[model samples]
Target: MTVTASIDIASSPEAVRAKFLDFASLPKYHKGFFASLTPLGPVEPENKIRVVFSSGQKMYAPIEHNTPTSFAWTGSIPLLFTGGTKFTQEEVFSGALSFLMGENAVARKFGFPEKTKKGWEGYNNDLKAWCEAK
Candidate 1:
């Protein structure tokens, strides 16, 4: 299943890009949803990053940044009772920024599709507020 969320920020695309690249500061706005975001190493197309959820579940993914335009990552969570779920998340910045999320059938079966869409909408709202404030 695939879902997307988008918002227009009262800031330039360049400003939003700069803020987005500062991965370390993500938790400042996302703290309620994510426990923490840690970079495994330097930023690169395939750089691995660790994302810890508030529930203590950990996920890892290779991140790709397309300069002042977009970034994306694919990751998964192991579900002992039902195999696992694979997901691809992308963020694109134009005059606005959009969040796209895609998950496998297994994930959809477990209701991840709708949850992810709502989650992205909330996250993007916070992101828009942050960017506009700067």
Candidate 2:
């Protein structure tokens, strides 16, 4: 299962993409959702970057998609969880554990997909506002 959310931004795709791809600026503009973001090095497919969520969870994921208008990453552990904050210009979740985890105890308790949907929506709104304001 995957949860995703997207919105139309008045800004150009390049401008929106530019702001989203700049991971380091996340905390400054997307303050409510991000604590701090640090890119380990040159960002490109296969490179790993570190992200600290506002909830204080620090995760590391490999760059899965990086392009002119899209970006995504995957944080995985063998055959289990391939999850994280879903930092795509879109908010998303997937993988073997997307909806299955030891009888869905933790996932159901935390409502990962639902919660993520809300967070992703917030991100979309935040991104749109920032991009338009520029």
Candidate 3:
């Protein structure tokens, strides 16, 4: 299963993508969702970065795609899950256990999909605001 969210921003894709990649500059306008980024090591053509969220969760994802209009990284558990936490470039989440991240009892108890979706929504809005302001 996979979850995705999209938002249309009144800015060029290049401008938006630039801000998204600028993780350190994000907190100023993106609220506190993105805290900081620590370089783990050289990852060949692209390096992996550790993104620390305001919620205190740290995600170490490798840059998989970086172009003028889109950006992506793979933070996965081998065969289990992968998440990038885009716009219509839509941030994605997928895994074998992803089905459990629905409206089921346990999912509701833990706010799996809801909280995750909300986080993406907030992220999209923040990105939009920042890009438009630029």
Candidate 4:
């Protein structure tokens, strides 16, 4: 299932898209999220970026359909399921939530776990607050 949520950022779409493109800078504002990105080597275009977490979970998505109003990513999540841990679970679910939302409004109505949905709500709220504050 997909859990999604959206916020109407007060900033223009260009600003929103710019924020999205500045993923590598997230570590400055978002604690614990180590955004490690690398070009997809010779196999893909430069726009194809692979983002890895400090937790070892990785997400690969192209900078698809980038515009002043929208930014989208199409990619698969990697998993190495073993036993279990809080960090692992959080990483997997957070990755899924980010993929589903893509920071869009319609995703607010997407269905998923109640906790996950609430988490996205909080995320969207945070985004709105940040965008509106500046």
- Give the clash count for model 1: 0
For candidate 3, what is the TM-score? 0.74
> What TM-score, over all chains together, does every model reach?
0.66, 0.74, 0.74, 0.50
RMSD of each: 11.2, 6.6, 5.7, 12.4
Candidate 3 Cα misplacement greater than 4 A, ranges: 38-46, 76-86, 89-100
Order of the predicted models by TM-score, top scorer first: 3, 2, 1, 4
Q: What tens digits encode model 2's per-residue C-alpha lDDT throughout 12-105?
A: 6666667776777776677665566676777877887787777888888787766654566775321111122222433334667656422377
Clashing pairs in 2: none
Instruction: Please write out the lDDT profile of model 1 over residues 5-35, one tens digit for every residue.
Output: 5556666666666665577788777655456
Error of 2 at 45 (Å): 1.6
lDDT per residue, candidate 4, 42-93, as tens digits?
Answer: 3223366676755577877664444343334455322111212100112234
Deviation in Å, model 1, residue 88 alpha carbon: 12
lDDT of each: 0.55, 0.62, 0.61, 0.45
Cα shift from native, residue 90, model 4 (Å)? 17
Candidate 1 worst ten-residue window by lDDT: 78-87
